[model samples]
Target chain A: MFYGYFNGTIAPTDQLAVGITDLGLLRGYGLFDYFLTYNGRPFQWDWYWARFQNSASRMHLKLPLGKDETYAIVMKLVERSNEAISKTGKATPTDVGIRFVLTGGYSADSISVEKPNLLILAEMIHPVPAIQYEQGIKVILDEYVREMAEVKSTDYKRVILMAEAIRAARASDILYQKGGEISELSRSNFFIVKGEKISTPDRHILHGITRKTVMQLAQSDFQVEERPVLLSELYDADEAFTTSSTKKILPITQIGELTIGDGHVGPKSKFLLERFDELVKTW
Target chain B: MFYGYFNGTIAPTDQLAVGITDLGLLRGYGLFDYFLTYNGRPFQWDWYWARFQNSASRMHLKLPLGKDETYAIVMKLVERSNEAISKTGKATPTDVGIRFVLTGGYSADSISVEKPNLLILAEMIHPVPAIQYEQGIKVILDEYVREMAEVKSTDYKRVILMAEAIRAARASDILYQKGGEISELSRSNFFIVKGEKISTPDRHILHGITRKTVMQLAQSDFQVEERPVLLSELYDADEAFTTSSTKKILPITQIGELTIGDGHVGPKSKFLLERFDELVKTW
Candidate 1:
């Protein structure tokens, strides 16, 4: 019972569509933010909404609904999804993921900016396997940075084109490097732990909500540095990991052929993941 | 009158839509090519199709239909557009512009590759105003290079976000510069004319079909050089112009604040425009 909200109406995901003239489809001019619900409630809703607003503002787009209305719609979809599970005789309903897309809208000239199209998609959440999280995942490095890296634009052609290579390498994701600096992962923010200090690139990366939460969780116990993390520093790091809405603080045990710090989940990464889990469980 | 073909069905442009799960709309994983008709027939159809094929290959997308079937679908939309114009009581039917879009199909995971969705959009050709070509157009410079510059991926967020600045500068398009080299315009290929020499940047840009046609048209009389065009060279050039499917050989008189060769359309640009007109008239 996956549902979606298109404009003002809520409907089944399969029935939602955008017109052909939409710039999101025609020119790929749009922004999107994804986050999963925790215990049937949107986790970090304010943070996600703020980031979505920032993305829209940077892209010069207008929001179709206020924060309250958007939350209402998400709740409606969540209720519908859980109701379907209840009808299935399931005792415990799982969480869901919500995505907000704001497009440049329908243009008659195909170039002009008109009223924007807004779409919200909700799907059943699928968690990463516990073994992968316990053992950590591997990532391949790519020498590229996303254009307009600060904005959460819906342009992922670079990583999408790297699908074959990623699969061939048996990697989970691509860690983007540009000009000797490691910026971020394809879909998340990256961090490295050296001794008692934690560092991540502050520029040329999306400021992930999960990343922020993890930083706060470790602020009292470890030093947090949010500057440009150089590619050279990856070799000296004792532990590394990525953070996103879905993969909350999954360790990265390997990159390319280099095994990160003995090729096993480091104690620092496990500590941060434990803190993240504790924080989210309360939410 | 406008019509479009989606998958195997042809309908009015307004009635066409793509599913919400499409990667083209969700992640902007797609490629597109646009060309206009010459005398009710596709101008440079073979060249356009070849380039489209290259773009798809570079982007790792599969064409949904073979060449013959694609051509058939395009003709179907063209005929539908013309038929609608005939009902409007117009005696002289105008040529139409066809845009072929191939998107990463509906991905269940929103990350994996799937069968592509093909959409063909046909609209009545809207040629650039006669005066703009006579007086030439102005373009602003942006310091960025598109990722996967060789592929015609549907990522135009940079230029789309530049809409207000472009309008404020009264510029029709953006000229991309990277590492002191002038690459191409946001939607066209650029060239500078110096005396009898014609030069255009051959890398980090979309290889425009019209740009190729103009080079061939001028080869018999003018010296053509395809190489890295330096940003410094724009000031010394006698004339400049941009070529694309819609704006075929339109003169460019001003870039940023600098005037090109006395700030008016130069003789060389006029000559090439005349040649292009002559070549397209026969088709």
Candidate 2:
């Protein structure tokens, strides 16, 4: 069972709704942030909150609640969701996903929204299967650019429109490139590791919280570089990976037809993944 | 008393709602089309429908209703709205605004939506005040680019985020520019009038229905050129204006500190506005 915090009230996910006139629905003017919970506690909560606040500021959306208030609401929703799931004769989920959404509230004019509506949703976490980690995933290069690339806004039109192509290619996700410069993936940040160096694009991409942590962890052991990653560079990289909230470090073995580092999960990627898992426990 | 046609049911606008998990609300994955009604009859319904179909196709959203079916539903809503206003002891509005929205429907996963929710809203047309036309309007140039520039998706983040800057500048709307090339305004298409010639950006912009009509009308009497309009070109143009469904042809007398066409409405703009009004009557 899913639980949701709508505005200021906690309720079942089914009861959470927004008016059709909400700018988030009518104009797609909204911001969202999602992070995972481990052992019923939010992982990297402060970093997620800072990113959430930045996204709201970039989109000019006034979040209805402060970070602490939002944290309380999320904790309550998670508790309620676990209770509801237990009532269904199921064990409580060890981990769950939390999504905070802020939308330009109901509008009669359909142009401007003043009072923003906030929704917090909690659901069972679906982890990437071990098989994907054992055998790294393949990705395809697509020529597309996201709008408001900095803010985590609700305009995923480019990716959604390319859903068919991504599925037909049998690729896990797309590596977006504009003018031959690689940006990021549809839902994750791209990284390339060459020998003792790690690099990722620092501009025209959503700066993921996990990406920051990965960079910090990588800097401790390797030379980390944050700069533009071109499509041509990925073909020659010794190893490649993606970072996201749910998928900490996913190895990318192939880009289109070219394989990276013998087309297997490299030692660097494996080491980083292991380190990420170990670090998550400390949080 | 506002009326709305939601999915297949005609109900009060207050009853219109969408689930929080709807992809349209979550991912801003939706498309919309709006046109005006004159004397209780939709103006250029065919053009609006064609554009609506094109937008939906570009966004990969399957509209639930066909042209004829949608027309029938819109006519009913308009009639009901007129009746509601009349029953309130107010004069029946001669003009009304009709909006048709197609949203990626409720999704449990919030990533993919196969079913779509349809909404048809009819409201009394809010005409631009006469003073805006008489005194003309001032606009400012903004450095922003819209994503999926051709598709009319529901993502207006750039405009909303810049709302404060626009108001502080005392400008009516924003004229978006990228790399010195003038694209369009926040909600309208930009056109520059050089004596005996009219030009507007033909690419990387939403192809407005009213803009097409204006081009057709201008072609009958003037040399119409549809090409890229640059910021430098606008500073030297004799006159400028914008076109949309509601605000037919609004003269732009100033762009920042540059006064367009002697800082007053040009004769050509006046003539075009008059011609547009006359053409509307025959519709």
Candidate 3:
């Protein structure tokens, strides 16, 4: 039984609805942030919350609940969902994914809304297969640049429209470039490793929480550069990987027609993935 | 009483709701086109339908209904709404506004939806006050450029976020500029009149239907140039105006601190407005 924290109470997912006049639906005025929960506890909740607040502030959306209040609501919803599964004689999954969405509420003008609607969804977590990590994934180069690149607004039309192009390239994902500089993937941050050094574009990309954790882990033992990365640099790099909440640190072997450094999962990615797992277990 | 043609049925506005899981609500994946109905009839229905189809095509969104089929749905809904108002012992408004929306339907991934949802809304037309047309309205300059400028996607966060700045400047709307070149207003297309020549940015702007009609009417007696117009040109132009479905041909008296030619509605704008009225009456 999936549970959702809608507005102020828990409800079935199917019963959740937004008015047609809500600015979020009428004008696409909304923001969303999501993170994972491991072993019945939210992983890096503070980091995700900070980023959520930043996104909302940038979009001029106001969150109705405070940090602690919202945290309590999410935990309550998750607990209730797990208990419901147990009552049905089913084993509740220890890991789950939670999404926090803030939308511009009902408005007659369809341009701006004074109040905001907060929606929280708790669902079973779907993990990427271990084989994909063992064998690096392929990515294709795309020339699309997202608008308001820093904010995590609920506007992913460019990525949805590029689904066919990505699939035709026989790649798992896309790495976006604009003005000759590589920005990031459609859903993850892109990084290149070159002989003891790792670098990724610092600007015009979503500041992923997992990316931040990987950067911190990498900086402790390896040289890390946060700056503009050009397309030419990726082709010549020793290894490349992407970071996201779902994909912690997945290695990228092929980009377009070029293969990166022997086309195998690099030792650096393996080490970082192991370190990330250890950190998650601690959490 | 307002009525909405939702999917294949007409319903009350209060009952019109979209599921929270709809990709249109979750990811802001939707497009909307609206025009006014005059004398209980949709004005230029064919022209509006063509633009709607074009917008959906650009976004790779498939319309669930054919153009003629959708036209019938809108007319039926309008007729029913008028009948309801007449039964209430009130004067039925001859003019109303209709909005046709296409959403990417429900999707578990929230990125793509196979089936699209078509929603048509018919409501009382809110006409721009005659004072605004006679005395002209003020506008402010905005530096943000829309992504996928050709497709009329439901992403208006930039304008909503800039609402305060526009209000502070005592402007009715904003004229967006990219790289020192004026693109268009938030909801209308910007135009400038220089002596006998009138020009507007040909690219990176929504091709408004009213703008098309106005251009056709103006071409009969005046020079029309569809090219890039810079900010400097707007400041020095002899006349300026904006055109949209709701606001037909509104003169701009002031942009920022600079007052447009004589700080009143210019002669060209007055002439165009009269011609537009004549054309609408003919329709």
Candidate 4:
């Protein structure tokens, strides 16, 4: 369909983002969010906006509009995207994902200005490759600590750089560890399933949308304690997986040189993934 | 006259700065710099570009061209800018200041792209209002901290946000004190002139082009210590000033309720500003 939302309207998926002249791009002064819509209706879109608002507030950024105004803009764009998809026959089941990105607009070369540009964009749900889920993925631990691991700003150069360096050494993902405790993955929330209980690093992750959904879904199946999981915990865990918007609930069969359990998808990860699939449809 | 150096052959100012794009605007994943051109040539552009490259490398970002190629682009842009200003009456008298900005070029929705959109814009010197020199400015401290204050990324969301929020608070500038350490002003480096010694928290501020220049220029006359400046020392100074490309050496007359050095320009700040003017012209 029409990939996602932009501004206060929906256009083609290909036309979702903004121009390069925008200050957000010019200065890296923008904030964004990645979340999914449920059956054409954005699941927790309001919550996404809330987090976006919080991000802007944290950065002391002004999101062109208030909460209600921002919500209206998102809804309008989402509906427009749905229509575009229907017209183009790209609507696959009408269920999709959304990304809400906001920028500080443009600069007139002036230091102080009353108005700043506001940009928003959304996109569709692209399933992660089937290979990653089946065989699981390998991750490496980043020895050095990171800054701004809490906020979701566009300045992800270090995150990408570290991940690429890790990949060059033959790893799929890079996990940030502080002292001896693990924080989160570059883009996903990490979880360790030990015995029958499940635990994960708290907001060390992006407080991921999928991570939150998984936490809610697995409340009954396992105990979900929000805390930092050390690399030692990973070595002893029965299974490990990551929760992200796109990956949903993904298994981590191997980390560094060590294999988890039998070195394949563990029981807990599979059960959690099964439950995640069911939750997304309802969510 | 057009602000930046841009003409037929060379891009003029080289700071790995490139054109604006969706990727750069939305993500702030780029490198940038502003350096003064001595006469028609760059003074310390090379020094600034070194940090730009370091920032790019730190991010594991692959620039569009090698170091030499990028420098050529800047030289080209500067030539163009000079030609534009040559048409103006003050062309000979006017000096040049250039901004080098580069963006992560466009990609197909995915973030992993190898290429980047390069844009270089050069402009004449844009100094603060003349009145600011005679009468120092006021500043407010930011409660929260800015991480990686060293990276010269286009991410000014926090700086902008805090400035906007405190507009009504009679605060002219803002700087966050991280864990009780006075980190830096929003867009400039923080310094306090205590007697004959000029002290500032080393490395907590932008390794600013002007800041570095001022340090080198004043090293013979002033004892420059690059140690941490505590918040408690903010009021104890005879003078306080910040260094940046735009506001080379600006003295702060007041911080909150305290008026620094009899509420006027201190002797040390006055000398530095005077010396800074000569440094830029001769460099």
* Model 2 Cα lDDT, one tens digit per residue, A124-176: 67788898898899898888777668788887776777888879989888889
lDDT of 1 by residue, B52-123 (tens): 999988888888788899888888888888888789888646588899889998999988888999999997
At residue A172, candidate 2 shows an lDDT of: 81
Predicted candidate 4 versus true structure: per-residue lDDT over B1-283, tens digit per residue: 4433322234323322322224565456666767766666666767877887876666556665666766676666566666765677554534566666665666555466557655556665666888888898888777755556677767666666666656766777886787778878878888898878888788566787777888898899989988988888866788898888778888888876778878998888888888887766565
Error of 3 at B159 (Å): 0.8
Residue B90 CA error for candidate 2 (Å)?
Answer: 2.4
Q: Tell me, by DockQ, which candidate is best.
A: 1
Which candidate has the highest lDDT of all? 1
Native-referenced TM-scores of chain A, all candidate models: 0.97, 0.97, 0.97, 0.86
Q: Which stretches of candidate 2 lie over 4 Å from their true place?
A: A281-283
Docking class of 3: medium
What is the lDDT of every predicted structure here? 0.90, 0.87, 0.87, 0.70
Arranged by TM-score, best first: 1, 3, 2, 4
Candidate 4 lDDT score relative to the true structure: 0.70
| Tens-place lDDT digits, model 4, residues A64-162 | 678777666666667776677677665444665555566665455534434455555555567788988888988887764544556677766655556
What TM-scores do the predictions have? Answer: 0.97, 0.96, 0.97, 0.83
- Model 1, range A1-283, lDDT digits (tens) per residue? 7789998888888899899888998899988999998877899999999999999998889998999999999999888877776787876465889999999999888888889999998886667889888899999999998878889999888788899999999998999998889999999999999999999899989989999999889999999999999878878899999998889999999999888888899999988888888877878
Better of 1 and 3 by lDDT: 1
